[model samples]
Target: MNTDFQHGAMGPRPPDEDAIMVLLVDDQLMIGEALRRILASQPSIGFHYCSDPNTALKVAAEVRPTVILQDLVMPGVNGLDLVRQYRQSPATRDIPVIVLSTKEEAAVKSEAFAVGANDYLVKLPDRLELIARVRYHSRAYLNQLQRDEAYAALRESQRHLMAANLELQRLTKVDGLTGLSNRRYFDEYLAAEWARAAREGSPIAVMMIDVDEFKRYNDHYGHLAGDEVLKTVAEAIQAHCRQSSDLAARFGGEEFVMVLADATPGRTEELGTGLCRSIERLRVPHLASRVAGHVTISVGGALAVPEADTSPIRLVDAADKALYQSKAAGRNRATMMPEGVA
Candidate 1:
């Protein structure tokens, strides 16, 4: 067997870069030389040879030949077994295999096809027939490879698009200034939570919060300072809510709202009072206010067990009425709606 292969002598073309490349695996040097001469005339076809049957698969992997010409008889090796091994390998499984034999026999041809040989031909086949079969199988293999690459690219593009859409949806629900849920999202959440509470016979709490004399604060301190104050208050309110079932939102200018699931009236009042004290502790200056020297907040809350027949608006209206009472009563206190009011 010739150890020296003819691929380097024929001038190697990069694997998968060329349209067609042929690997001839035969123990006989004469057979390899004959096939090389036949394919040498075609400038488009690249030719490679491996005389050692043992090294045929390794050579095929390195060459990445589009089509392989395999012989049935080689010393210490069965060509059919080699074809089966080629089919089993991930690297060479998709490459077209054409079995070359000495005589045309029906049993040999049938056995060749049974073991995954694509096409079979007598040794030293007519040049035109050999070239035609190689081109036919190689064209189909290349087309399949291109399609696989295109499909993979499309899936990756879809993955990125879905991630971007999720981020966009999240942005729409958030307030740009306070990083709290916006009023629109708050309303949606309240309605959904109300329905859930009604189903479970659980109590829900709603709180209305207002910065005391905010217009005066904005006028005395520039609008930028007032904005910072609102952000600070929003953070305090969000932090005080604590539970995963609690949600805080910027309802509008100088006002915020919170929803708490499964909260009792006493618990709601306690949280509201704590929030007011937390803001006061910040010691933010409010020179123009009638409340206190430092900034203060007024809170009013309502707790109710939602019923299927009742509207969520009733709860919000009750909370709002309580908020008005807080403003009227010294402007810096927490007030809770009386039982049966909501």
Candidate 2:
């Protein structure tokens, strides 16, 4: 509530680039004012004053003064007690405290030092010596503060770098066009899934999808338009392929691949049918498609419980044969491979 204590006398103006602050604490109004005036004469130091120990503690957290000049004896809370309190607080613990007292006895000085005083000086002592000591400690305090700030900044930068690296890793595995797994990622995932299915004796289904008359559609519409169509179809197929075990990828050009782990023949068929219906609902106009309507796709699926000796190439061949059947039956359909084909 006391503005005089809250806002101390202005010191010699610091340069625009750099300024050091000092806090002067004393219960006596005259002593606080005199200290502020004296410190203000120093060009590098900015002075703050507090008559109450409580106010000084609060200001220590807010202003973060470099060097604290505290009178050892006071009416209520003495400087030694203030020094102890400041040293205990995490916020102001590092700040250097110089105890100012009229008591010049060694016992008084020892007691002040034991209470966490960094330095001790008698009241109204040698002005030049006092100013020299204040300057020395203030510079040291500022240097320490700068080091702490730099460390905090470095830690923050490391956190940001880690987050960015994680995002980059995620982007690498994801397809840019449809937000599905890319071909490279799908290849790795499929191989892992196949190995797991073989180990667990679970059925896995592989489907190869081809957009009917895709080359003709690309010839009719420019490559950009073909890309847009491909993206749309990919989205449709991905929508129908739901489940944590389901994997989809753009398999180059207008062809795509899907893997369904732990699926039965019936489940594979149902999923294939659902995907066919989803593409039909898209209503993407493909005038050049071989089918009766607009854009359409042919899906060939092969379901098998892989063995330890089974090769990846054999599974792909089975799926490719079913895709051929879908093309032969007429585009825009799903076909399953014969059990003994591979």
Candidate 3:
């Protein structure tokens, strides 16, 4: 074997900003070292030399070499075998492999290409041709690398934007003070529920609750204390609305609303009465009210099977009328709306 390798010539010069990594695999230690020194002298090429095909594969994975320079005749694993191995491994499959060999036969060249060799170069080729081949492949590899990085970055940004949009939607519909759905969300939900109830011929119930003597309590205890009372009362109401279809909301100052899906008139009244009793039991000391010794709530309930002719506002108004009746008849009591009205 004529292994009289040319060792002195420097490889292709690398770009100052970005250099292409190249892997040189050969069984002869002198041949591998010569190739490494030649390529290392080039400013634009980053060369990794391996005497074993397995070690070359390992280095290819770690460095992601842009170009592979393989020697065909080796003792253990030949250059053609190494090319097959590189092509089989997903990590190294796309790397371009050029076979450097002493055998210049056309049959040897054909076998090299059959095993996935990208280019075939005879040993001791002209230095200028070697440099040109390396430079062309390096530029192509750099282009692909840039494109892949840009695509990855774009996908990451899209994911972040989607997450931020979802967070914004959550904040918009959620009440800051009580962590329940706000009035805006409640209105939208009521409309949808009304439509569903009409289609299913199921009863939908509305409950309007007013904190007894809330205005007087705010005046006597200050707004901060009133806020605390409101939060506590909101929690109490939410506790009573345990079902997935039940919705509780703060319907403006000292007043709250609940929607009970598929509830009967009697069931609505029972739930409303229970909620009123729970608030009364809270006994948040409010000495200013004549109706009760402590803080309490009056509830007005209405239940109806929704129809195409019925609107969400009608249900609210009916509940409001019943609530007014409760306040007038005497505070701290629950009243049910008349059947025809709701």
lDDT to native, each model: 0.88, 0.78, 0.81
Please give, for residues 1-342, the per-residue lDDT of candidate 3 as tens digits.
222222222233222226676777777777766666666567766766666665767766766667888888877676788899999998778778889988689999999999898889997656677777877776776566556765367557767999999999999987888777799999999999999999998889899999999999989899999999999999999999878999999888888999999887778888888998999888899988888879989999888888885797889999998999999989788999866578
Instruction: Tell me the tens digit of each residue's lDDT in model 2 across 88-117.
Output: 998778878999888688998999889888
**TM agreement with the true structure for every prediction:** 0.57, 0.56, 0.56
Query: Could you give me the TM-score of model 2 versus the true structure?
Result: 0.56
| Per-model root-mean-square deviation over C-alphas | 15.7, 15.8, 15.9
Cα lDDT of model 1 by residue, 141-252, tens digit: 7767666765367557767988999989988999989989999999999999999999999999899999999999999998999999999999999997789999999999
lDDT of 1: 0.88
Predicted structure 1, TM vs. truth: 0.57
* Model with the higher TM-score, candidate 1 or 2: 1
- Among these predicted structures, which one has the highest TM-score? 1
Q: Which candidate leads in lDDT?
A: 1
